[model samples]
Target: MKKSLVYLAVGMLIFTICLGSSLITNQAKAAEEYKISVVLKALNSDYWKSVKAGAEAAAEKYGVNLSVIGPNNETQVIQQINLLEDQLVKGVQGLVVAPLRPQAAKTVLEKAVSRDIAVITIDTDADFEGKTSFAGTGNFQAAEKAGKYFADILAGQGKVAIIRGAAGDYIHDQRVDGFMQGIEGTAVEVVSVQPADSSRGKAVNVMQNIIQSYPDVNAVYATNDEMALGAERALKSANQAGVKVMGFDGSPDALKSIRNGELTATVKQDSYGIGYTGVELMVKHLAGETVASEVPVPTFIIDQNNVDASIRDLTKAFSRDRLEVLFGEDVIAEVFAE
Candidate 1:
């Protein structure tokens, strides 16, 4: 009877030990699960609005927690850097950032790597050693498309002007470089290129000044939607005739302008796709899947020919909070609320 009692105690002890070990292992696995955080340059512009919608929608679908935040303006690099640090302190498992200033965020990014948080850059890539990958529109190629579109719209010959965003932004600079290269040796003469600081008011002033200087400038290509609109307003105000303006990024205003023919065309950047894909790649990388280090989303130039359908697509893309799942009206209605 004593031996039997001792044996029963030993069996119970072993079972308890095994059960505790299993529980610990499961806890560790659960702790490894990730929550993604997204940081954009700024809010307000339709470009970042679409991006935020994409990231949020993706988070809902993937069963992961997501947080999206950014500065009030893209020009405030220090504020963006501080925001990254704040997210890090909040214990984000992964990050997707459209960096305002690349060099400013380098140290924090390295810190994020040290904490084993996966990092994927979106929209703008900084020169740094810590990013896991980059996923966004290929600005260079998109710019080339814009340039060619300009030439084609003007029938490959005209005096053209350019309005650029920030001075140091990779995406904006690439657009300008690609435009210049694309127009090299072509009959279209690039009349003036100036930095508009991504401000509509600044763009208006710069464009108005340009029109005053070169009254015959036939085309204007602004690197972003806001600047483009400003240039258009200036041109119309000055009563500048035959000057077809093009902008980048499919902003809601840009679409409305397209409908009105005030803006000739724009290189569509799929901001929603950028946001969603950035999160998707970050999650995959965390899962130990090999994703491309650089993903260049495709772009298209929308002229009068494809403007109607393209504008419709742009609206759907913009209404990211309301995407209807294919063949499932119930889910679509439930998810979209419209």
Candidate 2:
């Protein structure tokens, strides 16, 4: 009986040792899977915040080490490049970036690709040949759809003014050009097209100037929601009524404005999906799988007719419980507040 009891004790000890060893092995493997870094254009806006939330959700789901960083604003092209360089020096295995100026980041992204790091672009595209994939809206197509809708609403006759982003920004250029193409055959005439550098304050001033020059302007279109909101403020301050205003990016503020009957309409891009898919593509690439060259997130028009439903969907998507599931308990409050 004593001999049998001793043998049982020895077997139990071995089993315990094996179990602990197996757990450690799994933990180590998980850590070794991938270390991904995401860089966004800016973190100062609701649209970018939503993108961050999506990236965080994807990181949790994939059980990967993820770090997201961004400049203070989208116009800090040099700063964005510097951030990308810093991440490269950190030896991260994967990189997802939304380049404020794609051309400026091409060389850095090329170096990353040369080092065998998976590189994915989100919200913008770079011409770097080594990029793994791009995840973003088809800006031209989405804007074209918005323009068509706007023209139909105006009965194909209106004097439209365009407020675009930075002069050289490819994304904004596409949107501006696409919108023009969309309104080509209609009776709409573009009174003025100007760049607001994508800043709300700048857009406000720009809109004020446009209003001064063209008091009879029938409508306005902005490349982004921030500028649209700015235009709305300018129009209200000037007491200019009956002029339709449309914006891109179905941002939280834009939806609210639409609901309140302040803004006319907006083209809503899936900002969250862009961030999520950018990281997911990097993961797949790191795992030796193929990813498409471009992954286009869908966009649609949102106005008073559907703003309420859209708000409901957004609330559910960003609810505390859902955010907790994606971002954990500690980060729930921070993300929810955003």
- The prediction achieving the highest TM-score against the true structure is 2
Model 1 TM-score?
0.84
Q: Taking the tens digit of each residue's C-alpha lDDT, what string does model 1 give over 1-338? A: 99999999999999999999999876445434678889999997878988998887777666677889999887888889999998888878899999887777889988888888888999888667767999888888889878877777678789989999888877789989998877776799988989998889999999989988998898999999899999999988988867888999877678667766788888888888899889888777776789998998778887666655654564444443433222134533433342
TM-score of each: 0.84, 0.86
User: Which segments of candidate 2 are over 4 A away from where they belong?
Assistant: 1-32, 320-338
Give the deviation of candidate 2 from the true structure as CA RMSD.
6.6
* Model 2 agreement with the true structure over 166-265: per-residue lDDT tens digits: 9999999999988998998999999999999888899999999999999999899999999999999999999998889999998878887886789999
Task: Estimate every model's Cα lDDT from 0 to 1.
Answer: 0.82, 0.87
RMSD per prediction, one decimal?
7.3, 6.6
Per-residue error for 130 in candidate 2, Å, reads: 1.1
Residue 322 displacement (Å), model 2: 12
